[model samples]
Target: MRHQEGLALVAAAATGIQVGAAMVATRFVVHDIGPASLAFLRYAIAVLCLVPPLLMSARVRFATRDLLVVMALGIVQFGVLIALLNLSLQFILSTRAALLFATFPLMTMIIAACLGREHLTGAKVAGVALTVVGVGAALGERLVTESGTGEWLGAILVLAAALCGALCSVLYRPYLARYPTLPVGTWAMLASVVALAAPAGMEGLFTETSRLDPSGWLIVLLIGLSSGIGYVLWLWALKHTTPTRVTVFLSLSPITAALLGVALLGEPFTPGVLLGLGGVVAGLWLATRTPVASSDNDV
Candidate 1:
């Protein structure tokens, strides 16, 4: 049991680091490619990566009903949610975006309660409030200093992405209950690729191929690899942990992004940023500590 617990901790930590690094890589890719195109390539490459394992997995078989549901999840999760999130970068700083997305735990809790999957408790509510406060504290400086239509628009886009992501999380419960994690993840990724390919192709696929410098290619590759591997780890972690526990780790993304900015982009680490990081950590702990059913068993 002790060994198993340690393994779970390692898995969760790995998932968090991979996801954080993926976000940084995604930011780099977006510096070169447009959000839609970046999103298109992400899902496309992810689908390609998934194909081998999917073909070999015995759990790959799906009924028509399951396929449709998976397709819908892909549309909302990978296609729409990711696109909106990428677009949000145009208006918001990476740290701010990460902080805002950290609200996923709160959103998940509320949605689960509404769906009768969890009870609404005062502790959960407090946790949600703490999370919001933490995120606000972390990004408060930027919010105060930054003023523009684009910034506001970016904030709205990210919030919208959060809503879509929350919906996807809730909707995935049923399919996860019926299917194994890898197979479902593979199909969902395929569906996202199919959905994005139509519009992306019409825009002239590979038009930007000539424009990519070595660094751009490296960033794209990182995005692809990180997203593919990180998502798989995420699915695996979901299978072994609770939703709140899985989501709480997401708060680390902003902190990771801040560190990355300091290391890679030469961005300064201000006191406000540090304070915000503390808030985010506190909020995540509070949010995850609330009593909730483990939704991960099904996934």
Candidate 2:
């Protein structure tokens, strides 16, 4: 049990990094594609990537009722959540988008509490608050300068995406508890592909695919593949841990994005970013400090 918990923690952290990387990659790709198209293509390819493993794990099955619920959550995650995030990136930098996105832990905390999935503690609240303040500090000018302009729209959309993701994360716990993570992730993604097909088709997203160069196609493939693996790990982590604990590790994502943005996009690294990094780490540490008698672990 201890080993499983440790592994789940590791998976959660890695999921954060992979997600951050995907955001950075999306910054490059969304310029050439609409969000609907981007999301549809990304998850369509991701669904394909999940297929072989799912075939091997074909023995597991869910009742029709439970399957529908998971499928609905999948639509929220893949269609609405990712589609909004992709659109948000069109109007913001990857670093800023990541900063806004790093608030998912706070969203998770609130949703978990409201749903009776986890207890609300002072430390947890303080930790999420500190993390948000840090993200704002790290954002520096971007947060302030962009609000009055159209940038506010992007921030709101990203926040919505975070909320959607949190709700799905909290709601999916029961189903994940009853099923294997890979199969659950696979089915969810497949449902998303079906749900998103219409908007994507209306946009003629497939037409855009043919126009891309070899490098563009490569980027799409890598991003899709990353999503496939990252989502599977995310569901697996949720199987063994509390949603709050899993999401608190997402504080690392903005840090990862900042580093990756600097290296890849030549984005600036500043003193504020350093300060924010410390606060995020400290907040995550505090937020994840386990209560002695609480039932945060899913299993």
User: Of the candidates shown, which would achieve the greatest lDDT relative to the real structure?
Assistant: 2
> Judged by TM-score, which candidate is best?
2
- How large is the C-alpha RMSD of every model relative to the true structure? 3.0, 2.1
lDDT of 2 at 135: 69
Tens-digit lDDT track of model 1 for 1-299: 33543454456557666666777777766756667677788877877887788778675567899889988887788888888898898777666677678777678768766776656566656766675676667565765776555777887888899888777766776776577877888778878877877666654555545355898877777687677776766666555555555655666666676677778989787786678677766765665554445432333
Candidate 2 per-residue lDDT over residues 1-299, each given as its tens digit: 66787788799989988887888787777877778888888998999998987888658868999999999999998889999999888777666778878889889989888877888889888887887777666666665565434577888999999999999889989998888898889889999989888888887775554556678778888999899999999999888878887887777777777778678869788887788888877787777666523466543
Clashes of 1: 1
Q: Which ten residues in a row have the lowest lDDT in candidate 1?
A: 290-299
Candidate 1 colliding pairs: 138-276
**Estimated TM-score per prediction?**
0.85, 0.92
**Model 1 alpha-carbon drift over 4 Å, by segment:** 1-16, 147-149, 207-210, 290-299
Full-model lDDT, candidate 1? 0.70
